[model samples]
Target: MKNYFDFILPTPVLFGPGMAERLPTELRRRGLARALVVTDRGVREAGILNPLLAGLDAAGVTCCVWDGVVSNPDADSVREGIEVAKRNRPDALVAVGGGSTLDTAKAIAGCLAAGVAEVFALREVKDPRASLPVFCLPTTSGTGSEVSYWVVITDRRTHEKVSIGDPALSPTLAVVDPLLTLSLPPRLTLWTGLDALTHAVEAFLSTAASSLSDLLVKEAITLVVKSLSCAVDVGDNLEARGDMALASLLAGAAMQHVGLGLVHAMSHQVGGFYDVHHGLANAILLPHVLKFNAPECPDKMKTLDNLVEGEGFMEWLKRLYEKYALSGEKVEIKEEDIPTMAERARANVNAQTNPRKAEVQDIMELYRKSFKVVE
Candidate 1:
């Protein structure tokens, strides 16, 4: 519990069932004429972009598509997006996909604004400039990239996950419409819902947590506890989907202010090294990290336990895992990789805010537990 903290919700959000259709109106109201729609191929292939594109056209905003973003986006993808931006010369960036697409758009916008040639170079630049007014429409309810100020990109050369945190990376606006998430598969719904829960839990337990963040994360955790299963079990449950969308938004908002913990620290390394889904990695490691941190924040854990109906926080989390069959995922990790990953996890930015200080050995053990490896 920090005695002092600053809360930020810099990006204005439009949230509802049909808020995505209002994106063009938001852009036009901002006087954004030429826009580059940044997204992934899967989103484009799903025809999710069709209505939005039509809306942009009807609004007379010239749109160019950059559908090159991939999962766990890397520096190379950002560079490619930069090239597209250069060619299109858009005044605004409209990111219309999941976390990866949103993150890539932010990187491209930040790099271009800072006049940097590479994405990571923005990290070294003095007085980083604000991104080019990014408008995010998230197709998934996790990662909260729609409201977060940080961008995680894999370093292709080092094979290490790096996060660039600056207010400049925050999107200018977020349109969170649960209808967009209706098409999300059950597995993703489960993973992303768990990711939101992890974000709320980690933020609530963060050393930097403030009164505002505590409120936000507590509500977020509660929403996930109540609605995540219904959302996963019945993907078309609009009410459940809406609750999850709000939960993700609130969790993202809270974590951006208070920061995360060992779950994200270890998960970032896993995603960077293994190209695993970020949400999936977080989901797998969250319960183990919570257990490790419980001693440091017993009261907070108890509060969370209450939020999940007092089933015991860890036990409830384990039940959620079992319900989703998360332990059965065919993720592999070599014994030799543990040391390197532990080192990176220790050095990760998210580790600094962990309520419990995790040494390299602690991280290694947690990784083993997540993978069920014989130690």
Candidate 2:
């Protein structure tokens, strides 16, 4: 944590029950006319995009839709999105869906901004900017891709889910309407909410944490602890949904400044190799990572324990995870693959900010511990 650190959250957020209906106004305010809507089939099929799309049309914003984004978005999907953008010539990209859709939009924006053909290539650019404004309307309360200047896309060949962080990748506007998440199924609700909780926990424990980030993540943690269960079990509880939505956004902003820790570092690789749901992987790995780091950062661990009113942070987290986790669910990782995954985890961008240093062997041990939990 540096006493002399900078914080940046240039993206303005519109948050409320009916905020999704205001995206077109936001686009028009920014002088954006033609739009390319990025999303996945699930969001579109769920009719979550209807209100936003209707608003855009009513506002006379010409639109084209690309519902090609997939879970754990890959570089190939990004290339396909770029092709769609080239043909559409839109003035803005409007993302309507979960984190994957939001992240895919940013990846497309980065590629187009850099005039590159591939998403991964944009990583090497010294300064990458989106050619057009990117608007985000999150349908999930996790990943925080709407406000964060980070995009995680998996590489097919390398099996590494890479994180691309650049200030310009931040969305020009984010419309976080919790009502959109009401239709999320129980399984997704649990996983995504856990993802938000992981974000707060990792950001709070990050070595790069500043006073401001610590304050934000603390509130975020409290909200998740209070709201995640109701949001998951009840699904239609508006207040619970709103709290989780706010928690995700707050944690996303905090992590943007301070980065994250080993939970994210390890989860990224697990998702990359196994196509595991990112949040589920993080939920499974978080307690294990906490155990690994508790000795190094007892005060921070204690802070979390106190915040959640647990006898111990590890016990609290485990109970929360087990409550929603699939019975007998196991990580789709093999012992033979641990070496490669551990290596990838060691190199993950999130690893750098971890309070406790993790060598390859230590990461392998964490993986083993997490993996054997089901076995």
Candidate 3:
């Protein structure tokens, strides 16, 4: 085991129907008092924080909320959050929202620990120094930022999404409470669920896949396959929501362990270029990239095909997009941008994990094929 592989799940998790209510107690256990809450507008406006805040109040924990986090958290957004962090001087951080909000909170915590003014500074370093304690409450079950050791922070100046991988970025504690996600509407439900599916599929296909990650990814995929449709179609169903939350967490851990593939690399470039939702771009790219990588990992693809009820893995991925109505959204991307995006994707370290080594022209072809394919 020593020479073969190393696996670590650094965060302690508290999972249940109302686990977010346990936050104040958990913070106190960590010897924390004043807290900075990093979140997005949806969590606040949807009234998801009322009960959690009431619990914090009852536990005598004070907080300052920074709810300006945007989708695809950029350097400017994180810097703004850090300013809030500096003001509050909170002893701990509570990240409450979806993937973007959770990532914002993690970067804010990392910036405070590293003594850095901008998240981009931390991005340039191989292993950032700051490792702040973070309590994560995932209102969306998609990105799995709650349990992962990596984050994608966009540089505002260039609009390029920089992927940062460091163990220091993992949350100190993760609270997966399905009740908090009851407020997640159907569109978000579809996007995030598909994102979780992509995470599982990518990790399972990664060349770095180990016996340990394979087990985790398989279970994660099973959960998504069984629960995503139920969770999307019936948002308030506690059982389905709980399964998806677990699936996202497991898929995240698996991805963090084995790394991802060309899908994330290609889609991230598009997301940065077109300002498309990360998951939406991933949903569009998953089947195409998988088809490209399938030849290199036919045995793994066959395993996945057997697990999922479909004609083939490719058909299964297509059905997932169609089933969730993910194909209808217009991409609005310029054809001229395809080559640049492909070059950027090839340069991205994420593309290295593809079972098949992706060529520059291969990615270009993929990007061109993806443009205006919806009908």
Report the number of the highest-TM-score candidate.
Answer: 1
Residue 56 displacement (Å), model 2: 1.3
Model 3 over residues 172-245: C-alpha lDDT tens digits? 99999999998798888878888998999998888788888888879888888888888888999999999999
Error of 3 at 135 (Å): 0.6
Name the 10 consecutive residues with the lowest summed lDDT in model 3: 324-333
Candidates ranked by lDDT: 1, 2, 3
TM-score of 2: 0.96
Q: Lowest summed-lDDT stretch of 10 residues in model 1?
A: 327-336
In model 2, the runs with Cα more than 4 Å from the true position are 326-329, 372-375
Clashing pairs in 3: none
TM-scores for all predictions: 0.97, 0.96, 0.95
lDDT tens readout by residue for model 1, 1-375? 775877768999999998988888998998899999999998998898999999999999999998999898998999999999998899999998888999999999889989887888988988777658899999898889999988889997777888998987889999999999998989989888888988999999999999889999999988988899999999999999999999999999999988899999998888887788888898888877887998999899888878877587788778888887887245777788899999999988899999999999999989988874533
TM-score of decoy 3? 0.95
How many collisions per candidate? 0, 0, 0
Question: CA lDDT, every prediction?
Answer: 0.89, 0.88, 0.83
